[model samples]
Target: MKLPALLRRRAEPAEVGGVARLDRRTKNLTKRLHPGEVAIIHHSDLDRVSAEALVASGAGVVVNAVRSVSGRYPNLGPSILLEAGIPLIDDVGEDVFTLVTEGDRLVVDGDRLLDTEGAVVVSGTLVTTDVLEEQLEQARAGLSDQIDAFTLNTMTYLREEKELLLEGVGVPEIRTKIDGRHVLIVVRGYNYRGDLDVLRPYISEYKPLLIGVDGGADALLEAGYKPNMIIGDMDSCSDAALQSGAELVVHAYRDGRAPGVERVESLGLSAVVFPVLGTSEDAAMLLADSYGARLLVAVGTHYSLVEFLDKGREGMASTFLTRLRVGSKLVDAKGVSRIYRSQVKGWHLALLVLSGVVALVTALAMTDVGGAVGDLLLARLRDLAYWIKELLT
Candidate 1:
């Protein structure tokens, strides 16, 4: 089988500009990547969200130590990069992770990786839509296995968290008031950045009690908003976010051993430890509902089997059950933003400003000091008219 030259990029003889940015976790890499850099990643079966982020981040090239598209579930990431003209070198081998250090410069010419020291440390195959679609068609034939695996994971999640889902037990206590107010829970999931951009108006107008789950806090900060509360393991959160005066809630295992708690204490900031079942996002939703939030709006939430699988969970039992529990009050970011727009608009802002100026003029006209100032202005205008007539004569 042969692929077109357009489908695969050939080696460029010129030494191009690229600083290697490496990380095993695709999400972590996306957070740090900048434009014109080469991303050295180890994401196998990369999801669309991660791929989109990479493209948005403007990485010139991506060299993966594992398969970008392993013919699993029609992953659209590779296809997106292909459409955007981004080069993705797949399965360069795990040894590349060690050989390439952060900030190390590298020249990526087709399948070859040349270090600044002039050593070819890694190489792999170039991926294109044609290649991915062919592989996706083959992987689709094995869809039954994926479905079966997904079902088993769901069943296990339902069984283990039956009590919380049914009886509404183990909900955490929180200080930030949520009763009768809109609560927004943010996760650092796929397309979260774009979702937040769309929700900017809603966020400014309603000022919902903002909650960030782990790296989500950084996302919030990056988007020019401060989180009211941060809930997650300390592993991914930035120290600046912790000290940003937002209330901190550390997600811990049910047994009470919280690694994030230690990190918080080390940073000399006090945080409320939430020892609960499932993920931090689940706890955030439960907290909002328990505290009497009128509506719970969510950003970066994953609902599909592929989304959960991308998170590397065997099953999304906890998240699935949590969604079931958070039912009526919950709304997606897009849905809430659409609703909020009916009441908030650019013209409305212009009207408000116009009305404010009118009110200020009316108040000045009625005041004693304003009346004296107005008389002086009238006399000056008459004098100016007389002076203009004299000049004409």
Candidate 2:
């Protein structure tokens, strides 16, 4: 098969290897790499954050599964890869793993890099001085727009929160009024879905107040749980979920006007709008604290400087301030999947069957099995009939 010109140069290659560092985020996936390790930069969310991080880390090359958005939208990730002098391999497929055996000499042929085993080597790179300067200039040019967008979004969210607080609506507070109660604050991003899956079983045990922030509300509803309250500017939220009996809180700026609040009112849903000076997540945390929550658990919230930057805003100041206001009550759920074990296992099937048998035996002992089973089945049929009737109604 004819290969790209870059790969042709590596027709004769050697072998080398190291720990396989897989980067799903555009942050520096290779920042922690040792001198000779191979960095595999997987485009997890296909965001620029992971790409930027990989470039800053200075890996030898970067194998990307993500299409570079056809070079539009100022993809900092691929730009970083190219400018950092890192070899870029596009769509090398899964077989590329065989060529990477810890420490193999690899050759970069355009978007394909192959090792001695004739497999592709995945690596990443760092942003060199030249690329850094260019990136800075771009950032400087876009700073004003970034700030304006941040301000507008912040104002929208804050107004919603103020209205919520002023209305004295019986919305579930972020913190528990009852001592020892826990509050789970959910956001959508990163490994959020995985984290929520891990935390699902504990929901019933801890009985934490479920508060969904924006898209997090849909996540909760999808997981078969209803949020006690929903907070944010109401962007990226589903209409059905917003009207699912959860109290709505819109965050707006201190100017006392909130467009999000207007929308909430237009929907005929009463919302408490609060004016705050930070991100919607920040406002949510602060409101949770003010409402007397005992403990706050944060899921999928941005934590690092790069992540904050990825939000395309000067979030550091507000995030810092928000943390100070609620740090004592905050517990991050990052990597929670590693810690929280699922209670149900494959072995539970036998127990479930046994329980069913026991119930059947008890029914047989109390009454005739034939009649009991027939009656129980009829009851279920009646329930289904009612559901159908409701649908028609």
Candidate 2 whole-model C-alpha lDDT, 0 to 1: 0.62
Q: Give all TM-scores, in the order shown.
A: 0.77, 0.49
* Per-residue lDDT of candidate 2, residues 281-363 (tens digit): 87677767767778998888877644554554554346655665566889988778877777778779889999999897777
Q: Output the TM-score of candidate 1.
A: 0.77
lDDT at residue 148 of model 2 (Cα atoms): 66
lDDT of 1 by residue, 213-318 (tens): 8888988999998999999897888999898889999888878888898899898998888776678888788777877889998998877766766665564557
Find the candidate with the highest TM-score and give its number. Answer: 1
Q: Please give the CA lDDT of all the candidate structures.
A: 0.79, 0.62
For model 2, the run of ten residues with the poorest summed lDDT: 1-10
**Collision pairs in model 1:** none
Candidate 1 segments whose C-alpha is farther than 4 A from its true place: 1-17, 116-119, 335-393
